[model samples]
Target: MSSSFERYQKRRLISSYFSVVLSVFLVLFLLGLLGLFVINSKKLSDDFKEQIPMSVYFKDQANDSILKAFGEQLQKSAFVKTDTFVSKETAASKHKDIIGEDFMQFLGFNPLQNSYDIHLKADYVEGDSIKKIERKFKENRMISDIVYDKHLVDLVNNNIKKITFYILIITGFLALIAVLLINSSMRLSIYSNRFIIKTMQMVGATKSFIRKPFIMRSIKLGVIGAVLAIVAIIGVLVYIDSQLPNLGVLDDKLMIGSVLLGVLALGVLISWFSTFFATQKFLNLRTDDLY
Candidate 1:
């Protein structure tokens, strides 16, 4: 009967340990996913910013020299990422392709204006910055008019900012909830092992001596859980990259490495803190309250 009781107690402790580890894994998985979102959100925003076009139309009478000088000046500007000078003939051919050969016959000469197709720096995509850029172009004598889709630029900037902020808030809240839930679950697990802790205490063990084993176990579980979460995250990223090679977001090795490190650190920190606090609570509990 004594042997059977000891076996049963060992089984219970094993079960509690497994339960705590499983809970930690689930929480770490969620935290890893959140970290991925935070990293990729910035990448996606930059991709969209690159797509916003700001075109500067040139006067019909403007000479090639003036256009060339203007192009060089624009290239040197802080806002411009890249600029291509589209000649009147090239613009006309593109326009003709759109409207067809029959539409071109009605024109006496090529009516399409020469222009510079400009891609601005990511930071200049906002409405105020773009307006300032447009004003600078208007000051140029060779510029006919600056043409850009204002509404589209505004919509893209606004949407990206709003979505990023929303995701950040939601992810933060979910992470907090995950930490709290994991902490509670770990506390319950440690509480079930209260007898073992009590036995150590009765043997004149110091508080630190009794807590050492549980803390070590927690750290081990945390490291294992972090590794598993990183593997899962990598699998997801690989699948995504295969499907969308143009994502460009996942191509950054440094960013991805940082995110993985962050997830690992978060897992270890949360587990250590949770277990430490839980064990401290159990140590303080009255003998009668151990149940």
Candidate 2:
């Protein structure tokens, strides 16, 4: 009968420990997923910016020297990520490739003018910035027109702002849920040890002495749970990176390291506070309540 009681007590202790670990793992994994989304969004923004080119078309019968100089000037601009000078022949070749016919041959004269294809940096991809850049090119006599997809720029920027805002709200709400879940789990674990806590108090044990062992045990469990959560996150990231090769955000080591550190700190901090508060409640309870 004595051995059976001991086995039952051991099983109960294991069950309480599993409960704490499971709560922490679920919270940390969700947080890790949020971190990945934040990192990947930045990369996606840059990719979209590259797709809109700032095109500068040269005037009809413009001097070759002036066009060449303009191409050099474009390369010197801080906002220019890349620039390509499109001569009449090169433009004709591009059109032929697109339409599968030589329009210049049908028209007897190539109507296409020389142009410069300027790819701007991510920071200068907005409508206002692109407008300012266009005005700058208009001052040059050799340029005929500057063209780009203004609607596309506005659409991408506005949608990105909305997405970022919604993600922040969702993450904050989830964080509060995580805290409440972990705290409830910790309180239940402490409730099981109420008899031990009251017996310690009866023996003249100080509150600090009673709390020390529980705090230490909580920290250990928190670290273990964090490690397990990180392992699971890594597995999911690997599968995602394989399926989506274009998501270079997954390759960012520094950001991912910081995220992992945050997870570890959050897990440990929450566990420590939960254990401390739960122990305090048990200490303050009446002896009759322990029954």
Candidate 3:
């Protein structure tokens, strides 16, 4: 009977440890997902900003040689990511294809002017920055007009700001919840061994000596949990990439390493702190109060 009871207790302890590990894994996995989303959001925003196109039209009298030199200069500008010079003939051909008829034939002349289709760097796509770029470009004698959808630029900037604000709020709230849930799991696991803690204290063992084993156990569990969470997060990223190949979620290795390291550190810290406090609580209690 004694051996059977001992076996049951050992199994129960193992079960309790497993429960704690599983709980920690789930919480950290959630936090990891949020971190992934936050990191990817910045990249996605920049990609969108860089896709907004603008055109710099040249004066009708500007010759091909002058336009080619201007194009080379534009390419060297810090603000420009890419620029393509569209000659008058090419522009007319594109318009003709789009309209399904030769507008040049109907009008008896090609009226399209030579222009450079410019895509600005993401940082310079905002309203004020674009205005500065426009002013600088218009200073050139060969350039006639700089045209872009100013309203669209403003709208994209405004919407991205709103999205960023909401993401920050959501991230903060989710992080708080993750910490609370992990701490609670650790506390409950420690609570089950309260009597053992009290017994160790009553036997004249130093508090640090008594707490050492439990702290070490918690740390081991924390590492296991963090490793499991990281595996789960990688699986999720893989699934997302499969479904949305263009997202390129797994392309940023540095961010992924940072998030994984952060999750591991958080798990160990939370587990150590929670276990320390919970063990201390029972150690300070009177023998009768343990009931």
Model 1 per-residue lDDT tens digits across residues 1-291: 999999998998778777666776777777777777777777778767878777788887899898888988987798888888888888877877887774457766777788999998888888898898888888888788888889988888888879888988988887888789778767877877888888888789999988888888887777777788889888888888899888865778897888889878877888889989999888888888887
* lDDT of every predicted structure (CA atoms): 0.82, 0.88, 0.89
Return the number of clashes found in candidate 1. 0
Question: Given candidate 1, what's the lDDT at residue 132?
Answer: 89
Candidate structures ordered by TM-score, highest first: 2, 3, 1
How does candidate 3 fare on TM-score?
Answer: 0.94
**TM-score (all chains, Cα) for each model:** 0.93, 0.95, 0.94
TM-score of 1: 0.93
Tens digit per residue, CA lDDT, model 3, 94-148: 9988989998777889988999999999999988899999998888899988889
Clashing pairs in 1: none
* lDDT: worst 10-residue window of model 3: 174-183
The sequence of per-residue lDDT tens digits that candidate 2 reaches over residues 1-291 is 999999999999999999999999999889887987777787788878977888889988688889888878877899899999899889999999999999988699988989988899988998888889888989997788888989899998999899999999989998998889988988888898999999999999999999999988888888888888888888888888888877765678888889988889999999999999999999999998778
